[model samples]
Target: MPQLTLYGYYKSSCTTRLRIALALKKIEYTTVFIDFFNKEHRGAAYAAINPNMSLPTLAADEGDGQGPVYITQSVAALEYLEEAFPDNGVHLLPNNAADRARVRSLVEVVVADLQPRQAAQTLEKLGNDFNANQDQKVKWAYDWCIKELQAYETLVTATGLAGKYSVGDTLTLADVCLVPGIQNAVERWGVDLDKDFPALAKIYENLKAVPEVQGAHWSQQPDAPKE
Candidate 1:
């Protein structure tokens, strides 16, 4: 077994997703925090680790000849983790060809459309595009997100998610992609899941109550939106 270390930011949705997966797998690792909000990711030290200057870099080190394997992207990191250590023999992708396609399709909708929309809202708050109004930007983003969420609701509800997890009553990369986006929609974007999306609301609720999520340490001091 190799010792793993993750370099990521606290508020980064991609980082949060990797943290949840790490906890679920029970893989022990040290987290080196980088502050994306303060633009620490743009610094030279991080640039050396990942030229793309992205968060959530994975490194595996063992005492032997095995050096370190560095991975920058979130989905890429997760796929590597699933392949390397598969507990319960339940894979992120399904064993069946059709099932794998379905899961990939569902994830594609969110990854392609949902999270990037939220990222624009996040940047507006950070004053990235000065002309973009934060309130208007967030509202627009959420509207797009909920439209996709509704479509996902139809997909999941029809796919037998109620039994246990996102695909086939078991946890998968689908759940990994899902949990973080829901967190963004609820915590960061201030979208009300109960009102906007019931099926996904249930999925969120279910994932939260899972033993792994309940035990997983989210932010040390979690805050709700101020009234």
Candidate 2:
């Protein structure tokens, strides 16, 4: 027993990101689920583990016989786990600071591009609508994705074919961020990669082939369907 645990929502893009990293690293963990639809994230117990009340909180082994080490935030959690137990697993930051900075820049754009849509959707779900403002926000999010994905297409083309993901032929934190952004766009926002952005189509297909990237959960499994 490695004494590691991960708290995540099966359908959350953020949760899906961390889950891929842990799986690729071959780290064993017990996954705890939080229902996003029912707002189970607001529960007291989960909030206690994550003050931000977010998904993908990883509890890694602290080398003690006691409980695992607690961590929150998918990005920070991934970085922390990598540094805490660095044994040649996938790395978010390259050894060179310049490379690391470049990687972080790409990662930031991916995250920044995704947040606007999420905010818009969350507000809509909560029934707050400024009419014109909401419409503009939605448009901005879609536009942002188009521009960012174009840039990503160029960047990946420049780098050539990576055997795994983002930066120098292995899965990195940037890759972790990339997968969820695509998932969000495709599932919630209904962006068609093949039709809207053919350049991104190849990358999306490649990512889908990766087992770690797939994880164990699917929102529309044969047994489960949206009501």
Candidate 3:
């Protein structure tokens, strides 16, 4: 079996999602730290691996004699892991179609809606183009985090699908997306999940207690800065 390698930064929520999923699925892989602070991701070497110059690119040998195939997008990489290695570990998506759709819907609440706005590139663009200050950029991220988390809370409550986890009490892709999203919001953007979104807070608390999730924490990553 060819070794799996993940190229990412510890602080990236997207990267953290992949970490959580990989851990939950019991997939063992190596990591290459891409130092975002040094602008390593924008260099020619990384661009060769991922033309988009994004963090969290997953590469693995297909054992077909072809070079490793790389999955650039986090969500796409997750689905690839599920389909390609179904029997290896825990399933992140539900078996049923409706439940699957519900999980995907919740995933987009964080990936599509919230993540893009709070990404470093987005904040940098705001500063460069609009002359927005640090406080303003933080405000931009904070507002979106609150709005999206509130939407997530409302969706879970209204659908009644949430029991112990995001969908049907199982640790699905939705929870994988939620934990890191909330982490970025609370740690970077200063949104209090426990105070403003109690439902999500409770779920997050439970999810964090899981050994897989705890092991995948950003602080536990090899690239994370030491305190």
Q: What TM-score do all the candidates reach, one by one?
A: 0.84, 0.78, 0.97
Error of 2 at 26 (Å): 0.2
Superposed by TM-score, candidate 2 places the C-alpha of residue 161 at a distance from the truth, in angstroms, of 9.2
Candidate 3 lDDT (Cα, whole model)? 0.92
What is the Å distance of residue 2 in model 2 from its true position? Answer: 6.4
Using alpha carbons, what is the TM-score of model 3? 0.97
Worst 10 residues of 2 by lDDT: 216-225
lDDT of 2 by residue, 1-227 (tens): 34678887767777776777777777777877777677788899888878887776888776677766678877777777677657745555678887687677777777665544564345565345554465665565566677787777667666663444556665567777788788767776667889976656766677778777765345632223577
**What RMSD, rounded to one decimal, does every model reach?**
3.5, 3.7, 1.0
lDDT, candidate 3, 179-217, per-residue tens: 999999999999988899988988998998999888888
Assess each prediction's global lDDT (C-alpha) against the native: 0.74, 0.69, 0.92
Give the candidate number with the greatest lDDT.
3
Candidate 1 vs candidate 3: the lDDT winner is 3
| Model 1 stretches with alpha carbons more than 4 Å out | 62-66, 87-90, 120-130, 158-162, 215-217, 221-227
Candidate 3, pairs of clashing residues: none
lDDT at 139 for candidate 3?
A: 97
TM-score of candidate 2 relative to the true fold:
0.78
lDDT of 2: 0.69
